[model samples]
Target: MNILHLSAVNNWGGGENQIELLCREFKEHYPEVKNQILCKKGKLFHKRLEKTNLKFLTASLAFQMDPRYIRRIISICKKENIDLIHIHDSTALSLAIIADNLADLPPMVFSKKTSFPIRNRKQSLYKYNHPKLKKIFCVSKKTRNVTSEGIQDENKLVTLYHGIDPELQRNLKPGLDLRNFLKIPSERKIIGNIANHIEAKDLQTLVKTANQLINRENRKDFHFVQIGGFEKPRTSSLLQEVKQFGLEEHFSFLGFRENAAALIPQFDISIITSESEGLPQFIYESFFHKIPVISTGVGGISEIITHKINGLLAQAHDHKKLCENILILAENEELIPKFAEISHQMVLQNFTSEIMMEKTLIEYKKILHERL
Candidate 1:
């Protein structure tokens, strides 16, 4: 099937990474599926996609709606003879909807990557109150609930957990030299947070939780290493917040690392303190590396970290519970293996790129069958 996968960004965040990985898998596993990606020109992901059958088209969008860009996208879709439009974010979805109308289009699907409340209630209503959308491929149930609440096409929403290339992840096994690169001691117990410094990610909660551990005279050896970037304007306050808390000495903000999976093994524990998320791809990466995670219960996080099984979960925004979980993981070594085993099994069984691609193909075929 001919397809156009759309995304506005080319940066290295969870959503961007997810799109890149999906494109890569589509190219590798489904060669018959001719696909192109519509994106802003000259971005990192746009450049990276040069290596695939997925052709790249440039279309600038303002937030989730821009008429001029949508017109351009529609013209391109018609010229390319596209059969499916799969959007990775809202901005792309806006353009896709316009293109669909113009080209007498095929099926359209949006990959639900985040729980939608972050978009103000008014904006959410304006953007999602559509019936033409064929399906929503939610990466988690939490994301599905949020989208279903705002969208009229409840039956079209399908919960499909995000997936990664198990082989690629397995090849990048965790090791100790990552600590050496960070100038951290080989023996210091490390707690890592791999999230962009955004309000939705709750970096403040992560830092506060770290401080709570630091305040404990008994747990001074625990270190906090944050692995993400602040390229976006919304996250400008995080650097100042880190300084305000006097966490400069104990906290390591490594910006964005391309080889994050390689570094996962160096840290003794991983944490996700997001205010919202879909099923975070990092959770699967952590399990792939056999590193246990302690995350706040939000979005579809609970779908992966099944409390006391794969990893620990605390209530969202609750720094005390975060502190408690971190300390418990730090103190008890036996609990680590149990969590790792369960998580590894869970990811291998349910969340591999192979499974995701198969399901996505099925969805595409189903949509086409309905049109026929």
Candidate 2:
């Protein structure tokens, strides 16, 4: 079962991480099922792939529908005799659909990793509902539900949650002493967030939440640490807001740490202020580290985090409610361990990379069998 994974994005994030995880899983457990990746040249995903033993190819994507990039896809499919093409992002899907139209290509399986509603445009509708896409693996039920609206064949939409490798988490050691590096007092509880500086991440609300905690609530013992890529405009905007709110002392933005997950253990709590998500990888990593979480109940977050059971959840953009949840975890120390333990158990039982890959293999086989 030779599979070619496609990633058209230029940056590294949860979706990219899932591709790496899926490929690694196949390499270790199902060696017979070979996998290769074809990603945008000179990008973060391409760089990360270089560190791995997995087979991969790169193409120069100057534009969305670059002919050269499309030719590379067709050539690779023919040369590699790829049994299937697993598209990782919407851009890749668009490219794949074009390549399929020009030449005979293998069946495609797309991973819908975000809950963003599909655009109602004719092109968008045609690309998603293209008959070549045999399966659409949604990262969460909410993603699947949202995707169903744009897709014609509902059977293709499958809810397949992405997960972390617990073994890797268990063995992961902190690459840096965050408290020492950030010069945070030992007495101060660290509130950590791992997300890129993007509009969907709602980093503005994160700043507002931090302001409420430090200035409004007058809580000086809590420090907020954000770790992710420093996307322009958003990063500058967030910095200005942090400075404007006089939160420089309370907030630390450690832009794009490669070892971000390793720092989870140092966090007293984990937070996600995203207005939209398929489900961030930070939540699963936090579960493995036994770190309590406070997040917005957007996308598929509620599927894993039952409010007040395993974690606290607030509505999107509601900084006051987010602050209240944070205070709840901080003041009630007993609830901290309680929530962490429950979440830890949840990840072990259902949300591990091994479990995810096993289910994925089943789906892959089913798809292949149907073709036969």
Count clashing residue pairs per candidate. Answer: 0, 1
RMSD per model, one decimal? 2.6, 0.8
Local distance difference test, each candidate: 0.77, 0.92
lDDT of 1 by residue, 238-309 (tens): 667667877666788888766576788777899999888887778888888789999998988887777887
Worst 10 residues of 2 by lDDT: 166-175
How well does each candidate superpose onto the true structure, as a TM-score? 0.91, 0.99
Residue 3 error, candidate 2, Å: 0.3
Native RMSD of candidate 1 (Å): 2.6
Candidate 2 structure lDDT? 0.92
